[model samples]
Target: MEILKKSQSGSFESSDIIILIEPVEPNSGRNIDIDSSVMLEYGDTIKALITSKLDSYNISDIHLIAKDKGALELTINARLETAIKRACNIQKATMH
Candidate 1:
C-alpha cells in the first residue's frame, strides 16, 4: 500500500511507542529512523520488526519515524501495525 500522507499512532507514555509514517518518492526504498530509550541494545530488533511488518503489507518507498518509550516488542508491533493500517486506509475488522 502506498502511504499518501503523514500518519501517526501511539503515544509517548511510558511503555509505549509513537510511530510516524510519511510518503516518499517511489523507488527510494523504505527509510526508518528510530529514537529509542534502549537503542544501545534493542535498536536493531525494533527496526527489524518494523521492516517485517511493513513488508507483510507490501509497503515500501516511505519514511518511518519511531519514537519508543521503553516499550516491549509486542507493544511496538501492535502500534506499528495500527499505524500502517491507518496509513493504508485499511479498516480493521470487528468481531461480533
Candidate 2:
C-alpha cells in the first residue's frame, strides 16, 4: 500500500517502540531510520525485521523512523504494522 501522509503508532513506555512513517516519491525508494536503546548488538536484526515487514506489506517509497524503547520483536512488529496500516488507510479485520 502507498502511504498517503505522515502517520505513527506506539508509545514511549518502557517496553514499546514508536514508529513514524511518511510517504515519499516512488523513485526515492524506501528509507528506514532506526534509533534503538540496544543498538550495540541488535541493530541489524531490528532493521532486518522492519524491512521484512515492510516488504511483506508491499510497501516501498516511504520514509520510516522507528524509535525503540527496549521493546521485544513482537512489540516492534505490532507497532510498525499498526503505523503502516494507519498510514495506508487499511482497516483492521474484525473477528466473528
Over the stretch 13-86, how does candidate 1's per-residue lDDT look in tens digits?
99999999988999999999999999999999998999899889899788999999889999999899888877
Which 10 residues in a row give candidate 1 its minimum summed lDDT? 87-96
Scored by lDDT, model 1 comes in at 0.88
* Tens digit per residue, CA lDDT, model 2, 55-83: 99998789999889889999989888888
Candidate 1: segments with Cα more than 4 A from true spot: 93-96
lDDT of each: 0.88, 0.88
What lDDT does model 2 reach?
A: 0.88
TM-scores, all candidates, are: 0.91, 0.91
Backbone steric clashes in candidate 1, count: 0
